[model samples]
Target: MNIHQVSVNYAPEQDRLLIRINGKEGGELRAWLTRRLALALLPVLNQSATAQMTKLAGPAAPAASLDEQRDQLLDTFQKEALLRTGDFKTPYEDRQGQPANAVLGPEPLLLTEVKVTLMSSGQLRLQMLEKLPGSDTVRNFQVMMDGQLTNGLLHLLHQSLNASQWLEPVAPANLTPAGSSEVPELAIEPAKPRYLN
Candidate 1:
């Protein structure tokens, strides 16, 4: 979508960011971009950090202010999309003699939408919605983080959006009963997918 206008306002009490993106085609997207996600995108949108520094700067252009930061964020975001068309890697492994390769069931279902959320712990939570070949039935899968990620990896995430693919998801050992108020020490958990919806 061609973006026309954008805004980012911080809510200190809520520790949240209010982002509104207006597309040229009249579509509007609104979301509360979490602090971690904003932190993650800060470097990408910062002028001094990315390669766009030289080109985006012209003699008359003004330094990035609060308003421009939102524009920069939107500019940086177009390249980094949230939708998952059809890119997924099945688990694989190789051993000494047997060469144990995890069996990849069948061709993966077409992924309709994927949501990525940055947790306060500096980790990302990915929830994917995939559909069967010729039906409306869609199943959801999450790219589960097996362990705590290193600070370096987390830092790299600020630099690169594609770093998400490097993560792997696994099925939970035991399903938690629905409506369980207990946090599993892990965030396990869609709609079609929206910036905030």
Candidate 2:
């Protein structure tokens, strides 16, 4: 699908991340990311991003190291650069006067399986699946995202995860603000919705 916009939000009652993607062709896809799935997805997402960034950096990419801090610094730099070009300030446009053209169905799929692949074209392909509760039927959808969009999706997901507090809290000393140094931490509060375009 040609993605036009994406929104990920944390639903406290459901305790799951609701991911909504609006396609350029006016079709929408919605999925639910549960805590168990989110935990499993974190490592894969990180590995794919690291690999893609290293490939883009070519031979100039820094050598793999045991220094965790150094690796985090590099990741922070890349994320900041990507966020600069993102269009998060623009609110996600809602389909007006009628229900959205949902690709799978009107209900959001409870994603039971997700496959991540880095294609030869340098775009990441995500195949999401939902196994019907009492049937052999399974519904699936796929989306291709470039590096920047991948980073943006990851960013928004992280914000949702942070709000959900599904993981342990980090030490205050380890906390660092996102975006440029000039931008205060309050500017990126969890209450604000982030749109990936």
Best by lDDT: 2
TM-score of each: 0.27, 0.69
RMSD of each: 21.9, 16.0
Model 2 lDDT per residue over 127-156, tens place: 999986797878788889887788778878
TM-score attained by model 1: 0.27
- The lDDT of each candidate is 0.39, 0.78
Misplaced by over 4 Å in model 1 are 47-50, 55-197
Kindly list the per-residue Cα lDDT of model 1 for residues 143-170, writing each as its tens digit: 3221122122233334333322212354
Candidate 2 lDDT trough over 10 residues, lowest sum? 95-104
- Residue 153, model 1: Cα distance from true site in angstroms: 25
Q: Which residue window of length 10 is worst by lDDT in model 1?
A: 92-101
Off by over 4 Å in 2: 60-84, 96-103, 169-197
Clashes of each: 0, 0
